[model samples]
Target: MSLNESCGVYGIYVEDGEALPYLYWGLLAQNHRGHQSHGFAALSDGIRLYRELGMIPALSGEELKTLMESLPGRLGIGNVRYTTSGSVDRESLRRNAMPVLERGSRRSIALSFNGNIVNMGELRSSLGLPEGLSDAHALNRLLLRALEEESSIQEAVKLCMDQVEGAYSTVCLIDDGTLLAFRDPLGIKPLCHGCGEGIKAFSSESVGLDINGLDYCGEVSPGELLWIEEGSLHRERVRHSGRRAFCAFEFAYFARPDSLFNDRYVYEARVQFGMNLAERFDDIASRCDIVISLPETANDAAYGFHIASGLPWEMATRRHRYVTQRAFISKAEERELILSRKVNILGRKIRGKRLAVIDDSIVRGDTTRSVVRRLRAAGAREIHLFITYPQIIGPCFYGIDMATYGELIGAWRTPEEIAEEIGADSVNYQPIDDYVKATGLSRDELCLGCVTRRYPTPMADEMAREMWERLRSSEREGGRIYEG
Candidate 1:
């Protein structure tokens, strides 16, 4: 099976100095979003692109100077890629890495994007584009095609928004030093714009802007298009879809803790998630001797659990600082090995103790089961799992990795069954309504498709409905439904 990836995108336009440095820092701030590959495209001479298959390397002062000299430009865009819609093999990943530069009939452009296209087959067939184009490449082609036919760049973005059928938050560096940014009609992904000094930038999350000391300008509203060139900024609402569907999974599992969403920090919302869990499962909280987090992402939530339940929060599961790879995003075959080396268990703290373990979410049962086995071996007397995100009963067509019903444990098993399979005392998922409340966004503003089995976009909804119907009676299902 081809694995899926969630990615990060960054673009910057500097009126005086080179923009590559700013672009580099922005992508680095959000590298957690995508770990497989990194690339950059700068509009100097033409569109100079540099791509590699791995995380963005930490550069020394001399290395940074060399990179700046190689791709020096006042306008640049970069991406840390995770494949939501392409092959995951080494060659395929290398070939499909973003800052995907393409030449159209009239002009050349390089783009970095986050999110998936639901109607890729239809788009490819209708446009007569080639096979094997990743969703980002397909989007670049779509934009280039529109640019050829439309009178202005804004019109081209409008045309792409009107035709495309899934989430896309994109930043493009045109060959002529123009910086273009836009979000999908429904705003199913996170994209924001900020500025500092003579620098205007766009990123997948606010933490990128924060790292560069840029002031938070605001989000690129749903259906909005931004065109920047020669120190000027132009904005237009390209299409009004009458709703917003920002990916809810971002608040629960993906974004950095310091990242801002709807003016509130992600860690703040996760804390509320833990508090809600405590209220909902007070009996279980009463029985637990201590609260233990699954390291890194769940640390804040575990603190809230400790606060509400009055249980001591133990920093028992310490993540190895050097083991930077995320087990959740690694390929299936590599996930186990990464998880094993990811964290060390403090056997004395949890030994013979009824521990309440807090985690972000569980998609497939493998990672959770592995953690449970580790805890059991370390003498954990009891393990009750408190998960932040609601149960994922359906595949995500927007941009998440869980693409088939057969791969999602919640699609077929009850919480009690999941507990038994993972060898946990109990498994408690955050209630859907409580999760929505914690994010501070109304139900209409967030995409709960994976949890509720209802997608915000029409094509994704139709495909999911049909796929679920067919898979309901089958013993197993394989491959991404949208791709098929």
Candidate 2:
């Protein structure tokens, strides 16, 4: 599966009016969080919505001008989607795109959301919506139903949370003035709020706030609800006891280097992960002639590895940075395989050398195999692969799309077998104990569900079994694994 997180959300409550320009800047800052689709809805006298299934830059200069001319509101919500839990078909794309509208009690509510709702199937069945309605669509319908029966929008959200499960950090625009924002009990997804002059803003990452010159006011507390209207902001704590299981992958691979999460800097956290990985793998560090990192994700860890192991580092691989598009993730496997050739190796560095290649982790091992083969072709004598994280033996159910164990390379094969399969002299993974300690957070503070089979929440055994079966089927179809 693709290695993208969920969606990114941004909202603005403008008191002096005309907020589209600020919204545009905020979405641009968060563009890296997702590039598949772009959407926005503004509320003035009524809700106005615009959306398209492509990158922010794909909106032509004329289209942007037309949108700016047509957009009629001071308050707006915007979303950039990567699409984790749902399909990418046209109907799914159209229906699930956010800033979704639901009319209620003579006023309409425009809602935009990030993160997944794990118990969405149960909620859909309870609401009696179409069986195939996606998680986002199900959530929109459920919120409407709750608003119909409840006294206020805040009360409706609380009631809705009682039935909903999994990670969600959302923003809802009520009529032309009010904005509502809340996070999940565990705060698995990041959401922060800021204010400046007569305007208030909220986003999935603080980088948006930084780009717009808004003052940071801290994250939306786990299960805390906030209401912004008429230049005043009110806060209420909803659910308080759920353990915080923030996805560790956020620091390891997903979030932008410039963003801040849960009061900690993301880039710093990654550097710490690399430092800890170095400590764990120090014994084997001196055996290689050179240390090279897999581009992007492993760069930080490779730095840490160098510092801890006293090894010099070099950039051995080159990446094509211009290929950002929806087609990259949604295309057929053969096309993706061809696109994989975009990564190139520097022949002089690997030629006749004993090289240690450090990477974040191996998901399906297809990319790792390709990389190893390319390095061998470049005249490498010995290739030893070191991964910063532990072997991924299970799927992630909370929000990540790695929801099936069968797709994992480590799930069915031994490390030695993986080494032989990839033409590596040896493969060493960072120990799980060291991995957890490196974060400086306890087990309760992070989600290890993807690395281990123990889910934080209690999912039904049968449901878990069915998910595993589907995972195996996908692996078989993709030819991603060799069964023992």
Best by lDDT: 1
RMSD of each: 2.5, 3.9
Q: Where does model 1 exceed 4 Å of error?
A: 1-5, 475-484
Q: Which pairs of residues collide in candidate 1?
A: 5-83
Compute the lDDT for candidate 2: 0.74
**Local accuracy by lDDT, each model:** 0.88, 0.74
lDDT of 1 at 64: 81
Cα distance off (Å), candidate 1, residue 311 = 0.5
On residues 221-245, what C-alpha lDDT tens digit does candidate 2 reach at each position?
8778888877688888777746787
* Candidate 2 RMSD to the correct structure: 3.9
What's the lDDT for residue 32 in model 2? 69
